[model samples]
Target: MRHLYIHVPFCARRCSYCDFAIAVRKRVPAARYVETIRREHALRREREPGWDTPLDTLYLGGGTPSLLPPGDLADLVTTFALNSDAEVTLEANPDDVTLDAAAAWSSCGVTRVSLGVQSFHAAVLEWMHRTHDVAAAERAVETLRAAGIGEVSLDLIFALPAGMEHDFRRDLERAIRLAPDHLAVYGLSVEPRTPLARWVARGRTVLGDDEQFAHEFLLAHEILTEAGFDHYEVSNYARRLPQGGSRRARHNWAYWNDAAYAGLGPSAHGFAEGIRRWNVREWVAYERAVARGNDPIEGKERLTPAQRALERVYLGLRTVAGIPAADLANPSSSRSFLAATDAGWLTTRAGRVYATPSGWLMLDALAAALTTSPEGG
Candidate 1:
């Protein structure tokens, strides 16, 4: 099955910690971006003729997808043969969700709304440089529900430099009170070149230490799980059985499964036919390429078997499904598997290995250990 992703690269303002390829400008080039996406889509269809394969999921993620004009957003929906039962999701920010906007999105086949409600605490929101206030987030959720959108997910951030244990717990409690179907909780990471990094470098901000973050992370996990949320992925929790117990964000799952997907728009990435390609990061360059009837893809990589295997382990380990036991039995991997199991971070039952809650926190280390050969040899 194929999944599709369309990137909307315009945001009103960049958050302090955001590192995604986004352009924050006063005026958004909605029309130009839509045209380029269509051109890219047409070119991809001509090469693969795979549009007929009903798309199981269509995700419109971005700088802020809700920033797009209603008409432009609807045009994107019309461009794809989204399966009748497709999980059409739109990633939106709280400030962008209006009653009219929510209705417009629902009319265009958006079945799920992922709202960016980083924090309900005003101080924390300000610290993170978010544009919306706590009230705006509440209104956004109410608006989506009022617009008849049943599946709502909220995105949250914790371990802010200004956050405390009580503050983190309060955020989780407030989010749960809103009753969203899913919650995407993330720990703040200071990416190089981001404002957060600059603040840390200049001693303007002091992030929570590793121990503090670990405590908060464990606390949030416990709280959410006790509240009946499934810690399906390290950072994501959902109440319902993921469109009927299917194991993940379908669009993202495609990447882990190494399935074909066509990513459209500037800075988007596509993987198909064993080749990975990415578009230019600048909108001007992307538009120019599309205007010239060129593919606009700036670079491509052909995956080696070793690279693909490494990717499988890397992605598989991040989810609750864990990696297959057979994949871990190679002589090179057996030692790390046994060590991790012994350490209580992983367990094997009925031939499938799964990570415990503690293991999820150190997933990267576990994955590295599993993929590495024993001994420096």
Candidate 2:
């Protein structure tokens, strides 16, 4: 199924760990950006001539998508042809969520809201340079659900700075109590050129080690599973309803499952057929490219069969859905998969394989091992 992703690169303030392409704007340039997105889409439509297929899922991800007024948000998403029952999602900052904004988004046809709470603890929020406090996070959840949003997804960062891990359980427990439809817990990482990295370089901040990360990651998985949440992806948990059904993040699942998707805006990535492309990283460059009526995509690579095979393994390993065993029937790949299972890094059930918790911890190494092609097919 075709998916549409609109990237909004505006944020209130740059987070310490954010290395994504973003511009902190005092006033969102919503109208101009939306126009650019449409222009670029037209160019792509001309280039392909067969992109009129309606999108199955539309995701508005960002710097902070909620920064857009609901009317503009609607204007942005309506640029595409979406399926009748498409899953439309918007990512919002916890501090920005209110009854009015949530209600506006719901009326705009957003099926899901992914709140960027970061952490429910004030200290942790402060360390992460998040604007929202514990109370605001709680209120965001309450107000959002009351606003009639069908799905509420909480974004939490675990394996925090030195002292925060001690109270991490409290944050997890509080999130569970909120009863969100989905939870995405990410283990913190210090990316290069970010404030957190500079702090570590200056010996001002000491990040957690692997064991610390493992502890908190396992804690979240265990607690959420006991609460009846499905560990559908390595870092995502989808809550099971009382009716015994679940709704996965359709947009992201498309990525993991290697489906073709189109992305708009700066630094957004898209893939169709075997080609993977991304727009320019800077706002200025992307604007200039789009203004010229040419593709803002600065780079693209066509994947070979082996490369796609490796990607399938890598993406599959990062989720509950493992790659087909037949995909690794080659001698080297089969040996690697067998070795991974022997070391308790993977498990097989029915016709599929799943990553164990330990496997998730060493996921990269495991995927590489499982995709090691011997010469050619």
Candidate 3:
């Protein structure tokens, strides 16, 4: 099955720590944007007639997809044919999650809403330069629930420069009270060129030290697990469900499964038939290319077999389902797995290998150790 991701790159304002390819513009031409995306979708289908697989998942991610009007959203959703039970998700911010908006979204085929609620503390929100207050976050959750959108996910951030243990615990408790179906908790990292980095460079704010961050991460895992959320992925947790119930985000799982996916709009990426392509990041350039009837792709790369294998290992280890035990036993790959296992960061049982909770925290290092040169020279 194939998956689809539609990127909406317009935001009302940029967050201090965001480094994604997003445009903070005062005015947005949503109609024109959606039309261009529809054209791109049609063009891809025309080029690859065999790309007619039923879409198992559809994700509307952004700068702020919620910023688009309800009618525009419905038009975009109608452009694609999705599976009967496709996991359709929309990423929204608290300020945009009004009761009317939530109702409109549900009617437009959005079955899940991932709210960007970084923190419930006023200080944290201010420090992050988020537009919504704590009350707004709480109200948004209530509004979504009232609108009958139950499969909701709340996002939280920890490891702030001035955040204390008590603060982290309080934030987790506040989020749990909302009773969301899912939670995505992430650690704060000062990315290069972000506003946060600039502030740290000038001594306006300090960055959390490694020890403090690790402690906060471990605490978050312990608290959420105790609250009955399954630590399915490094940054994701979900309420325990009954047997054969839906427990994972289909769209995210598709990426881990290496399923074919088509991405539309500026800065979007697409992978099909071993060919990976990305559109130009500049909106004007992308629009111009599409207007001239030229492909909007800025670059493309064909993956070699070895490169694909490495990618499988790299992306697989980050999830709950680790590499198969048989694959790990290869002489070239066994050493890294064995080393990590010995360090108590990984465990092997039956035919499956998975990272321990600690292992997930250090996943990047573990994956790097597993990747080897093709020649083994």
- Please report the candidate that would top lDDT against the real structure: 2
lDDT order of candidates, top first: 2, 3, 1
Per-candidate local distance difference test: 0.81, 0.85, 0.83
lDDT of 1 at 23: 83
Q: Which portions of model 2 show Cα errors greater than 4 Å?
A: 330-335, 373-377
How high a TM-score does candidate 3 get?
A: 0.94
How would you encode candidate 3's per-residue C-alpha lDDT over 1-377 as one tens digit per residue? Answer: 36888889988887999987787878877898899988877777787664577778889998889988888988998788878888889999999999898999998789999999999888788878888999999999999988988589999998888642238889999999998889999999888899998988998887788887788788888998888788777888888776733356778877876777888888889887788989998777887888777788899999998778677776777777787766543633566666788898888777777888888878877766666633211
Clashing pairs in 1: 241-245
- The local distance difference test score of model 3 is 0.83
- Arranged by TM-score with the best first, the candidates are 2, 3, 1
Best by TM-score: 2
lDDT, residue 186, candidate 1 = 91
Angstrom error at residue 296, model 3: 1.0
Least accurate stretch of 10 residues (summed lDDT) in model 2? Answer: 368-377
lDDT of 2 by residue, 1-377 (tens): 38888889999899889998998999988888888888888888888754688888999998899999887888887777888898999999988898888999998789999999878777778877887888999999999989999999999888877865457788889999999999999998989999999998998988888888999999998999998898888999999878886768989999999998888899999898899999898887898889987778889999998789889888997888887666666533466676778888888877677888889999887777766645212
Question: Local error of candidate 1 at 168, Å?
Answer: 0.6
